[model samples]
Structures are given as C-alpha cells and as structure tokens.
Target: MTGAADRVYAHLGKWAPLYVWLLVVLIALGRTFYLSVNVSNSLPGKLFLVHKGAMPQLGDMAAFRHAGGGGYEAGALFLKRVVGVSGSIVTAKDAGAGFRDYFVDGRFVGRAKPVSRSGEPLKPGPDGAIPPGHYYMAADHPDSFDSRYAAVGWVAQRQIVGKAYRIF
Candidate 1:
C-alpha cells in the first residue's frame, strides 16, 4: 500500500511477461552457444541461474564454462570431484549394469551415474581405459547422474568449466 510497493507492483505487472520471455530467449541463446562450443555433452552448469529440478543434461558444453556462482548463474557453487580423467582406466564391477564409484590416480573421487534421461552407463566397460582429452567427473551422491552413465558419458577436457573449489 505504500508508494514504493505500488510502483514496484505496477512495474512488475507491466513487464513480467516480457521478463520471462527475455529469460527464455537468453536460455535458448546460451544453449545454442554451448552446443556450438562443445560438440558433446549438455550445458556446462545449471541453467536459469536457478536450479530447481532433476539433473539436467551434461552435454551442454557452454554451461560448464562457469567456474562458480560468480560467472553467470546465481546459486550455491560446488566443487565436482574428478573421478576419472583422460587416459584413466575405470572398471564397473557389476553384472546388471548400474551406477558405481570412480577412482582417479588410485584415489576415490566420486560415483558415476546417469544424469540424463537416456540412462546409459559410461563406456569403456569395467576395467577400461579413458581416452585422452576427456575428463570423467562424478558427484558424491550415488543417484547423481554422473560420468558413470552414458547420457552424460565422458566430459571432454575442453568442456570442463572449472575444478571443484569448495562447497558454499
């Protein structure tokens, strides 16, 4: 009911739709830019500047360009553990084809799982070698769609936006 509140509400009402449309356009542009940048994977980081849904596709290369929250989006920045990297050997010890943890340089980093709707497992099979120029990453959560799955297969070194710094 105050003058400032009234002015704010009127301004929002007039441009809410336009603002939303602008956001959509930006997202589309970002997606396109990412697609152009990286030939594989989903957007680098989360889109919309706000993460509020299940894991998104990791194929977007531009999305990964962000190092932390200060880049473009606004959210809690997280450090992604490097479970597997280029030329690293990995093995999934399971018969049914499910998620599993990944190791790098003989150190446990994180687990690999599907982060996309395809639900495909990471390639190279158990005890396989990761090709050069590709970096495999995974989250701490088992259910997290990580490098262990195919939907997000191997994350190219060029697609890596930033190394995990610290949890905010």
Candidate 2:
C-alpha cells in the first residue's frame, strides 16, 4: 500500500508543472483576445475599450479606421469624439478675425484651420446636416486631424470600429 501511494504521488508531481504552464498560456491568449477585439490605443491620455456591436451616440468617443490618411496611415485606427450623428446639422463658416468655427446642431464646438502643416489648403466639408449612416468626429487637441478637413469629412457607419470608453 505504501509503495502504491508513493508511485501515485510521484506521477502527480511530474505533471503539476506542465498543467501550470498550460494554464499560464491559456491566460495569456485570453488577455490578448480581449485587448485586440475590444480595446483601442489610438487615442491620447488613457487606454480605452470599445463597445463592440453597440451603436455610437453623440459625445461618445469612438475608434475607427483612418479613411482619409491617403495610405500614409494605412490600416491605422483613430479615436475621436462623436460631435455629430445622423440628422445632426454640421457647419463650418468664418467666425471673424480669420478663424473658422465649426458647429454641430447649431452649437459652436471648435475651430477648423484653413491650412495644413504642409501649407496645403484645408477645405471644409459641405455645410449642412450630417446624412444618415454618417458621423462627424473631432478631438480636443487643436491640431488633431479630424472631420474638420474635407479629407476626413463625414465618417460612414461602416468605418467605425466601435464606441470607446476609458478603461484607465
């Protein structure tokens, strides 16, 4: 009886480390999946998680693909606040003193400069309401490249990855 018990204990000890390593690997994979499909690192400040499969609302920060990066940021993702949603009116007009003011739903939000860093003219999107299945996004940073420029105009629904929520 004692010999049988000793053999059983030896076998269990040999396999314990293997089982522990397997568990560690499984945990790593799970964490990777969570970060890849549900979190975004494109925004400044803190790491955020995106609400996958949920509808984005105005004032929500969202993660989306860069459609207007002109291949410079191919496959790059961006994070910005949703300023205008479907049926929301968005306009860009002169705000006196050579500055352009951006409006959403008839309320002032921020300014849109008329030139890019390379001295190219930055044209604004057509003034009016945002169409269905589209959105307007912006960032708090003054120099952020966002919907203020025509190149990054209205973002279509398909381009949005998910709505972001600060995690840290």
Candidate 3:
C-alpha cells in the first residue's frame, strides 16, 4: 500500500477499540434515555423524552402500559398525567349518577364520562385515598381513556414504563 494509505489504516487500528467502546456507551444511554412519540390528543406535545426506570411523581407525565382492547391494542404504552399518586386522597362526586367528578387532594382532576364517544358505558375509577403503588392518570381532554374509566383503571407502579417529558 502507499505510505499515506498505510498510515491511515494504522491510525484506525490504534483507535478501533476506543471507537467501539464509545458506540457501546452510546447505545446504553439511548436505551436509558429514550424517546417516545405521543400519538394522542390527550397531551399537548407530540414528542416526549422518557427516563426509563424512573419513579413517577404527582403531576408528572408518565408513560405506562395500558392493558388494552378498548380502542387500543393489548399492552399499549400510553402517556398521561399523574393526577393522583399513591396515598393521595381522591374524591368522587356523583349527583344522581349522571357523571362523576374526580378530585385529588382537593384539586380537580378530570370528570368521568358516562359514556364513551362511541356510546359505550364507562365506569368511574376508584375514590377515596389512592391505593399503594397505584395512580390515577388523566388529562384535560374529556375523551381521554385514562383511569377515569374502567377501560384503563388505576395505573400500578409495575405498569409504569417511565417518566415522560414533553419535548415538542
């Protein structure tokens, strides 16, 4: 080989292990700090950055697995706001059983719709203090299929995939 070609090949060989190690570190970080695309109108942003294995906090955006089949696939991952965290008091007000209003720690969360957009009946979520290792997920959108309905009930800690941050 030419002198320059041999020198270039030698340089690459010297740094080959370092380059491989850098690539491996990058792949690990990519898995830990992952990106998610929000596909629903329940949240404001369309792009989200999730910190995998992070514990979800109240009022934080959380990505969890929806035990689906009601307008969603089985084991669908969802992004929603954590309104009621574990050990938080949740109150449900039902006037003549028309529609129930949910409040967490005296703060208004969201209302449970009597029927879905397709006219399917939706049962209200649990009231009183939230159970341990569970959360009430919801959003401002009235049609959001979250913890307010029986379709997506209480979000357990095991079901939470990660804590999400809206990027866009």
Please give the CA lDDT of all the candidate structures: 0.46, 0.73, 0.85
TM-score of candidate 1 relative to the true fold? 0.42
In the predicted model 2, the residue pairs found to clash are: none
Tell me each candidate's TM-score.
0.42, 0.68, 0.78
Give the per-residue lDDT digits (tens) of candidate 3, residues 99-157. Answer: 88888899887888887789877777778778899999998887788887777878889
- In order of lDDT, best first, we have 3, 2, 1
lDDT of 2 by residue, 21-66 (tens): 8678657655432232322332465666666555589999887777
For model 1, the stretches where C-alpha displacement exceeds 4 angstroms are 1-79, 95-127
CA shift of 21, model 1, Å? 28
* Error at 69, model 2, angstroms: 3.2
Alpha-carbon shift of residue 99 in model 1 (angstroms): 5.5
Task: Please identify which of the two predictions, 1 or 3, would achieve the higher TM-score against the true structure.
Answer: 3
Tens digit per residue, CA lDDT, model 1, 1-168: 699999999999999999999678768755332222222222233332322221223222112332222122523222244556557776664433454555555666455443324544344323467777765566555444445555345655555544222111
Alpha-carbon deviation at 98 in model 3, angstroms: 2.5
